[model samples]
Every structure is written in C-alpha cells, then in structure tokens.
Target chain A: MDDDRPLFFHVMAYADDADHDVIDMVSGDPDWEPPTALREGLREFADAPVADYQYPPSEGRGDLRDLLADRHDVPVERLVVTNGGGEANHLAMACGLEAHAGNEVILTDPVYPYYADRAELLGADVTYAPVADDGALDPETVRAVASEETALIVACSPNNPTGAVYGESVKRELTDIAEANDALYVSDEVYEAFDFSGRFHSALAFDSENVAVTNSFSKAMATTGLRVGYAILPDHLVDPVRTRHMLTNVAVTAPGQHAALKALRETPDDYYAETRAMLESRIEHFCEALDAAGAEYIQPQGAFYVLARFDGFPGTLDNTKRLIDEAGVAGMPGDAFGSAREEWLRFALVSPRADEAADRLAAYFS
Target chain B: MDDDRPLFFHVMAYADDADHDVIDMVSGDPDWEPPTALREGLREFADAPVADYQYPPSEGRGDLRDLLADRHDVPVERLVVTNGGGEANHLAMACGLEAHAGNEVILTDPVYPYYADRAELLGADVTYAPVADDGALDPETVRAVASEETALIVACSPNNPTGAVYGESVKRELTDIAEANDALYVSDEVYEAFDFSGRFHSALAFDSENVAVTNSFSKAMATTGLRVGYAILPDHLVDPVRTRHMLTNVAVTAPGQHAALKALRETPDDYYAETRAMLESRIEHFCEALDAAGAEYIQPQGAFYVLARFDGFPGTLDNTKRLIDEAGVAGMPGDAFGSAREEWLRFALVSPRADEAADRLAAYFS
Candidate 1:
C-alpha cells in the first residue's frame, strides 16, 4: 500500500520515459478523436450563464441521469453518477464491503489493477478465482471460491488486460452464484461498446437484484479524463451508495456531465459501429503480425488489447523496460495485472500507430 | 450514519421543493459567473488532441501543478490536485488517521458537516473542541480536548456557516498543538480569498511539519461545479495522500483542470478584490436588514455565509421549512453543521439577489 507502483501509473510512467519515437501501447487511453458532438458540447456549455458553472445536484444533473437511465433501462432512482467508471466501481465495492458480512472480496485472477488497489485501500480482504487459459471466466471456479464470506464478485467483460468477453452462460452463472451466496456482482461494463462479439451480455439481463452495473463514457465516448461514470444499483444499495457518493465527491464535474449528456443525445449509433470496426481492424492487424512472429497470444474478443506470452523474457517488468528502451515499443507487464500472469505482456491497440508498435514487437520477438 | 440529511443536499432539496417565486439562499453555490479567462480556456482546450482528453497524470498535470506551486509558494512535490476542496480534506484526514496513534479526530464545535460525515465514513472517532459564542476558536479549548489521542485538528478559516476568520496567533497555536499531540492540522482555506479581515492566517505559515492546507477554485473561482481543489501536504503525508487521491478519484477532470490553470494564470489580482468588495456589501446589507428586524446575527469576518438565530422556531428543520413555505427565503439549519448550534440558520450571501432575499426575511419576521 505504501508506494507499490499502481499498474496504471507504472505503465504511464514507462511510456513517458520511453524514447520520443516509441509507439506507446502501455496506457489504455484511446488515441482516436472524440465525437464532434462532445467537443461542440463544451463550446455550448462555455456560453451558458455562470449559474450553470455552480454546483450541480450531488446525485447528478437530472437530464444526464434520465438519459443514462433510459439507455441502461435502469430506473433513475438506482443510478448514481460518479467522477468516472473508477469511482463508480469504487463506490459499488465500498457498498459491498460494508454489507459484506464476508471475509473476502472475490475477483478474477488476472484482475484490473485498479480494483485490487482499491480493495487494499478500503481494507477489504481480496481473493482471486482463476480465469481459463484463454482468459475467460470458468463459472464453477468462481462459484467454488465464493461463499457467504465473499463480499462481492467483480466481473469485467471485454476485460482489461485480457479482452476476453464473458460468454452469456458464464455471465448467467456468475450472477446466479452471487445471488445464491448473498453477495453483489459488480459488473464493470465500461468496455461494452467495444465488444467484437455482437453478443455482449449485461449481468443485469439475468434479473438478479444483486447486480450493480458500472460503466463510463471514458472508453466508449473517448473521453477518459472527463471523469464521468454511473452505477445502476440494486434497490437496497441505492441510499447507501448515494450517501457514499455524496460524502466522497459531492458530484461529478458539471461541464463534463453536460458534454456527456450532449454526446449521448446527439451522437449517432453508427459512431459506435465505426469505432468498433476501426478498433477491430487494429486488433486483427496487430494479432496477425504477432501470429506471423509465432508468438503465443490470447486473441482479443473485445476491448482494444491482446495478452501475448513471452517465455524467453526475464519476467514482465524487465521485458517491458527492455522493450521500451531497445525496441521503442511499450506495453504493460502481465505481472502488473496480477501475479498469476507474470509470463504475459498486455498491449493496448489504442494508438493509431498500433500497427507500427506491433511490427516493432514482431521484429523484437523474432 | 443512516440517512441524516447532509446540509447542502437537504437545503437544495428544500429549494427544489419550494415555489418558483422562492428566494433561495439554501446552498453555498455562488450565483456568479466564473472569470472570462476560465470560459475562454474551455474553448481552447476543446480543440486539443483527443489524447489530451483521455487522462491526465494521477497526481495532476505538471503545468497546473507548477502554476499552483508558484501561487502557494509550496514545493510541487508537496501538492496533490483533488476533485475539490472536499476531496483534499478527505485525503488529508485519511493520512492523519493512518498516522495517528490516536483514538479521536478533533473537530471544531459547530463544524462543517462534511468533515464530520467524512470522519464517520472513515471510521475515525470524532471529538469536538468548542468555538466561542462569537464563532471564534479558543486554542486552549482545542488543546484541552487534544492529547496523544488526537489524530487530526481540522481548522477552517473564513469558517463555513459562521465565517469567523482565525487570526495569526490562533493558527500558530493550533498548528503547535497538533505538532505536540502528534496529529496533523488540516487547514481548509477555500474561503481564503474572501476574508474581509486582512488578518487571515494560514496553518502553512507556521511552517509546522504537522500542517496540511486544502483550498479550492469552487468558491474563489465561482466554479464549484468544476470540482477542482488541492492540498499542500507535509513532506511525510505526500505519498499516502497521493495513494488515497489516486484510489478515491483517479484524477480531477481534465477540462476543469485546464480551465483552472487558465484562471490561475490569466485572472487579474483585482478580481479577488472586487469579489470581496461585492460579497462584503451584500453581507452588510443583509445584516442591516436583520438588525432592523431585531434578529440576532454574527457579523461574518470572512466567507459569504451569515448564521442568524431564530429562537421562536422549534428547531432549524422546522424554521427552514416554514421560512421556505411562508417567507419564500431558504437557508441551511445550524444542526446540519453540528448539534451545537441548532438555533442558528446559515444564509449564503452568494446570490446576486441577496438584498432581495434579506428584504423577504425582514418582511416575514416583521
């Protein structure tokens, strides 16, 4: 907890220190332009009266909540807008921990580091259930690990580091397991829009009342730094989550909310389709280059990342540093995600120059 | 902890429920525009690369940090830009609690409600040191309540609800006591710019290693909705505060930061002077009206709020409700700040319509 470099910061710092010409695939930030609606929305917001710049309702501005409520099909009362997907997830986890008469917060083995870091910060006991070799959840394995003592089970689909979209059956199993164990399912679907598989399933579809779905505009709208996200809570957790949200941040920033509201209302559905298409091409391009180099990798089903295994390397941190220094390419170490995947390296196909980054990796691996 | 209405939300709810003709002064949100520079800055930022909107450094962007460092004359390493002054206080208190070999987090009697809320949420044992009837701190009272069991001493200058600006000696004594008690002094100076008494002193001015100062652009920049604030930490608390900050809200929103950076760089010195002058006039006008109506009030030496005693009412909640329903004026109850001041009703002199609001109060009382 004391200065153990959180993975995101470590990767971003590595990218910053790399050569100016380095093809940075380390950070998850998308490189493409945001929708014109988002940029235009800022200008429109700037022109509004200063009163609009004052504190918004701590829960959120009503219009944005209504928009998201309709989009997610959740009641407006269950939603609490947050600073970003991170806060949304954090709030849900906090709620779970408080209600947790449990000993451990269960997470996937190859976890999003932020979740692990937050669990530690909140003093919740964390335990991991391993993902399949293909980085997909094995429902029984998760069920085997969870119990009345399991505070919450976190599921990330089109997952960070893995990009293995959980299949419908797996989603149903996890939801059922959480419901049976009296634990909450924190389904982080920030990557929902980026699914390569048309069959992206929300845990909410299962109707278990125990699910809290957290999502953000960061990845989908290409505005990660805007710090706006929301959580759809179970009826029981609504008041507590609202209280925690109020005590923690009061509300999300105003202009970001307005821009997000505008983006949701004005942007076309085709924009998401185009983004998916563009990112799929990038993923395929990178994987093909990796395939040509004969590297073992989990082909991403969704999200813009691929986890490639490199056996000859001297662990991930060393490999990542050498890769940045010698190959002029940057990707995250698998160990950064979790200790279980130390031989793997994760690449985010976020940059427009991702192809060049892949080619650099190919040459280095060869 | 079970749904006690936090002050701002409670007041805003009353305002929301009141008739359209209500003269609302319930919340502290300034009813004024942010500087022209801040508005124009958002326009400039909107055109930047999509990556610029993706994520900023978790601690903060260097340019903004550098600007704040120059402004506060603190080392850049000692500062952490937070979501708002609320977060700055939260993070600093977190550090103090972790370091405190103590049982209690010391607060001023009739304290800002958010601090107590945060302390309760963090599981810190909260104890109060009484402020004099004039809403001024008596250092000995704080010292008497504190010992090795004190984890933190929170001092708000241009204090909320009461607006009694602490003098130099009081700040020094508080810092010295915190140092002696092995506790941290979290001095919230968000209202530093609004101090009518030129004698306002910063805890940082004492040069105690135990001191941390939190401030924000919310009140000073008239951009509470923007949610940008910062803390200047003692060298020791820096890393822990950063960790807490990173975990709580990964980073402040980007455009808000850009606008804040612009405001800091481009706003003229006279803006602060003019704001103080305007708020002073409003406060003076309201107090004169209250005096004419034979109402007891504390003359605010700083900040924009005036807490008036309305003894005829049963309690603050009832008084505030009837005031909103009958008199068409809204303000927060003193009980919301703490249990010690239920007879008081806090009016934020933030609206351009402050004079009109005061007239309504006078007419109702008469």
Candidate 2:
C-alpha cells in the first residue's frame, strides 16, 4: 500500500548523517570477517596473469562450476554464476517467465522487497500469498493463486523479516504446485546455512524438475560485497538462464569467485558450527531481553532476524525512527517489507555487539 | 538473423578441446596485466575488516564515487558503479526506456551484438541505422530515424567490431538529435582509452542534459573479470539509474571497486601509452601482412578489431571454422555482429603473437 515507503538503507543513511551514536540492528550485513583462506585467495588472484583478471568464461570458470556442482550434487551444466543471489533470482524469474510464456509471478506477502520490486521491473505482474500466522507458508493458499499465467513462485527458507524455516513438507508442496501449474519454483536459499531449525529442507532435496534453487556465498562466507552467487536450475531452464546471464552480468567477478571457492574448499566444519552457535546465542539473548521488556515478538527458528511488534508509535516508520533517535538503535520498519508488517520492526542480529544493542532497546521499552 | 551462431568463446573452447596450438585472435580481452597498484590494493583490502567486504552503499562506495566524480568533473550524485560496462549499458537503456515510455531503441548497424540482444531482452524494439562504409556515423542518416518512440540512441565510439572512432561533429549531431526528440543518448566509451585516431571525444565532453556516458576499467586496466564500471548520468536521470541499479546488481563487488579505485588513482600514464603503442604495432604488423596477402579490410582507426573481408569460403561461419581448423587461428564471424557484415570476419589484435599469427595467415593465403 505504501509504495513510497523509504527503504531501510535510506533510513540508515539518514540516521547516519544525523551523526548520532547509533547501534545498527538494522542492516543485514554481517559484522564478522570472512574466512582467512578466502581473504588469502584475493592475494593469490592478484598475483596471477592478465588473463586471470580478464573476462572469465561467461558461464563461469570450469573449476568453480565444478566445485559448485559437486557441492550441490548436480551437474555443472545446471549452474550459472551470477553477481549475487540478486542476479540469480532475477535470471530465474526471467527464464521462468519466458519458458511458461506467463506474465505473472507469485511471491509471499511480507516478501523480500527485492523480489517484488525486481519482478515488477522486469515487466511481470506480482500476486502475494499471505504468510500464515506463524510466518510459514500454507501450500493450499499458494496453490489457490497459481494459474496458467503464473510464471514463477518464489520461496525463501529461514525467511527474511521472519525467521521461519520451511520444512520438507512445505517445500515439496511448493515444488508440486509449480509443476502442476506449469510454473517454475525459485527457492531463495541464501540463508540456508543459517537455519537454526535442523528441519531445514532444500527444494533441491525434492530433486524436482521444475525447481531452481539460488544461493550466495555472502551470508555463509561473510563476503556480501564480493557479489558472487549462483543458481542450480532444472535441465530445461539452463539454456535460457545461461543466455540471459551472458547478456546481463556476464560472469561474477573473478577474484570474488576465487575467494568463494577457496572458502568453500577450506572452511572447516567447525567454522560453520561456531558461527551458527554464536548467532543462535545472540537470538536468545535479544529475545529474552524483549520478553523482559514486555515486547511482543516471534521467536526465530532460523536466520538472524526478529520481527518484534511495536505498535506504540504512529506506525512502523515512526516507531523505527523514534528508536533510532531515542534508544540510539536502528532497525528496519515493517511497512518497508509489506502492508502486513506495518506494526512490526525487524532487527538483525548481525552485529558483534548484539548484546549491547538488545540492552539499549530493552531499556527504552521498559 | 542467425541469433543462434556460436560465440567466439564457444568456438575457442572447441578449438582448445581439439588440442590445437591455437593462436587466439578471437577474444577481445587485452593481453596485459593490470597496474601493480591495483593488484596490491587487493591485498590491502583482503586484510581489512569485515565492513570492507560487506555490502557497500547500493549505488557504490562513496570514496570511489567521489573519486570518479572528481575525475569527470561532475557531482557524485551522477555516477552509479555497475558490474561492468555491460551492466552500465543495460541500466542506461532501462532508465532511458522508462523515462521516455517508448518502445524503440536505436543501435547502429554492424552493432555490438550484446546491445541489440539486451534491448530485445528488456522488451524494447530495436532499429538500426547503418554505419558509413568507413564505419563512421552519418549524422543525417541517424537524424532521419529519430522518432517520438525512439527512447534511446546507443553509440559505441572507438567502436567494437568496426573500430570506428566517431569524431566531434558527428557526436554533437547525435546529442542535438536526441535533445530535439526528447530521447536519451547512451554513449558507451569502454574503449575510450583505445582511441588510436587522436580524434576521440566523449559524449560527456558535450555537457548535454540528454547524454549519459558509460565507461569501465576493463579495457584500460585489463581487469574485465573484476566487474567494475560506472556511468555518468544527467542530473535528472541519476535517480532512475540509481533505483534500477539497486534493484538489479545491488552494488559492484567491493574488492573490485577498491582495486579499480587504486588503478584509477595510481596508474602511471605510460601504462596506457605502452598498451596503445603495443596495439598500434600489432595493427601495423597485421595490416601489412593482409596487404601482402591481397586481403581487403577496414584499417581500424581505434579499438583492437579489424573487419577483414574473407568471402573465400561459402559463409562467415565456414570461413571462421576453416581458419581455426586449417590455420590454427580463431576469430568471430561477421554474422554474429549483424547480417550486413556476414561477408567479413572480425580479428582481435590483442594477442602478444599478433605478428606471427598474421604471418601464418598470410602464408596460408599465398
């Protein structure tokens, strides 16, 4: 309803320009450094020859694709390297829309704004399937909206804004619905590695012919700015995806791909375990504080965000700004996400100082 | 018309698989290392904090934008860093089409295939104005095609495929026509530093509100894989470009922006001079051999490609494949560029062994 609602990045910038001592619970970016091996790879790439730094094979370098394919247990032909998860999702929608010859894309309400915005930008109509009360999908509701004109249905697991991790049953239903409707399913799994719920099931786990799963190294490797991400598509979609990719971003940055590959190969199992443990601990710490302050919020099952209800102020934007000015903390306004989220504020637990941030907000509410 | 023709990269890969000692004249990638400072900057960035590798300000890093602004003598608000010259051009067209709400985009005949493909991909109609026999733009011819529905006029000077460096008068005429028709002029100057004619001028040099100039460090720094390029937009167009960029690629890779900034700041003047000199020598060597072999070709005024007429074979694809199979050389077919040039083959002089390759061809012809 509020298309003119300012994006969180703009609000963050405005708060930053105000020059207050603000604690950032607003941004999705991790404050932790990437693995040492990944950083080291940058140096190695720098010292390589001109051709190494020149334009890569447009699909991607064979070695990196091989690594990705092996990791995903899919053939290299199914993957196309992209600028980030952003481009991967965009290409999937483009390919899906073309293949189905459809004009409409289906997204979940309280959606990741980028998905809704990009679909519109690409000249496709968007219809939302409202999230269930617990922030999980009800497959029947999604099915009701599907039609011959539906090109794609996008699902995010360990979802943004609300951290509900969709389980195997839900993912299967989504895959089935897409197949029955002749629409493609785009699974945004960039946050898959952050699933606190051990029940997280990949759409790839379904191994369905109509599903395309997109992931990025940003969240897992802590290198969001490097812009290396990819999609593993069904056999039928590869040609169109690769063609669109070649005409769009070409290939992801070479050094970033090199770094991601290094991180993938060398990052110890303990590293993920430890990072997940840290995020889980922070979520608990923040949620406990919210409880103590009598704040209403959903307990996260996966990912690092908490959607806390704060209807005291005029609206989400006003509440978010007031928090920034008064509590010296910044969080994303719910209205910026969707009309349904207007009474909630989404806080990211990406800061190393998450404890202090929670204390400040708790004190303000108390 | 044959959009299905194999790209040179595909042919090159096939040749490599055939295990021939191929002299690669197919790829337009420069065969020189990037500036030492830029590579060294990568190492520095690798050692920086997590914040350095996190998502940058969506448009770009402020420092890089500020530097670009100062270099171009424009305000920081006018620039948007992109994945590469590819994305910059894509965004320029997207912004132009939206602003004019028009369906048609104009490209020159014998055009870079990417522009035509991307325009069509974005759902805009494409019309071509033929380049003069010498490969330069004819102002009157272009003016005749400018209609109310012409949302964009794309010009690539020091042109790809043809290597024509448009002079000041023609560029002025283009800007005037665009302004008179309320159309946008997108000047792609990625090859700006490769101008050998000493007659090159940027559309930005015109200081018109209708012109948006896009450039990249790929050609000059030989860092095409780094995915960093920027566009200088008119003040009014900046918001649209910025919004489109945010929805599309998010931001250029962080390490790349850093590396490019270093290259922009510290590249010695002689690096460009030496590269130009090397290319000039290669062109002379190749053209001289062609003369001896009785081959007819357009002598490149700028850029690295020479469109040589080689109608000896049944078609350009046949000629190209035969050259690879027999002479152990690779090149792009003219049909890959446009139907009018199907009688020609495009050779890139970016190889260090350009002279030897030319000699091999000359001997084969004799």
Which candidate has the highest DockQ of all? Answer: 1
Q: What does candidate 1's lDDT look like per residue over B1-366, in tens digits?
A: 733355556766877876567777877888876888999888887898887898898888899999898877888999899999988998888888897678588888788888888888888888988788888889999988898988899879999878999999999999989989999999999999999999897777777789999999999999999999999999999989988888878889999999999999999989888999999999999998888777888889999999888547634687788888888788887777777788888888988889999998888787
User: Per-residue CA lDDT of candidate 2, range B1-366, in tens?
Assistant: 123325665677766876677788887888887899889889888888889999988888899999988988988889999988988888888788888747888889889888888887778998889987778889888899888888899989999989999999989999998998888999999998888999998888889999999988889888888889899999878988887777767778999999888888888999999889888889989988888777878888898998887536533666777888888778787878776678887888888888988998788776
Off by over 4 Å in 2: A1-6, A17-20, A311-315, B1-5, B18-20, B310-315
Q: Write the per-residue lDDT of candidate 2 for residues A1-366, one digit (tens) a residue.
A: 122225676777767966678888877898876888899889888888888888887878789999999988888899888888888888888788888757889888788888888887778999999887678889898999999888899989989978989899999999999999888999999998898889898899878888999999889888889898999999888988887787767667999988888888898988888889999999999998888778888788898899887546534667677888898888888877767777788899999889988999788888
Q: Candidate 1 local accuracy as lDDT?
A: 0.86
By DockQ thresholds, what CAPRI class is model 2? Answer: medium
* lDDT at A338, model 2: 68
- lDDT value for model 2: 0.85
lDDT per model, in order? 0.86, 0.85
Best by lDDT: 1
Count residue pairs with overlapping backbones in model 2.
0
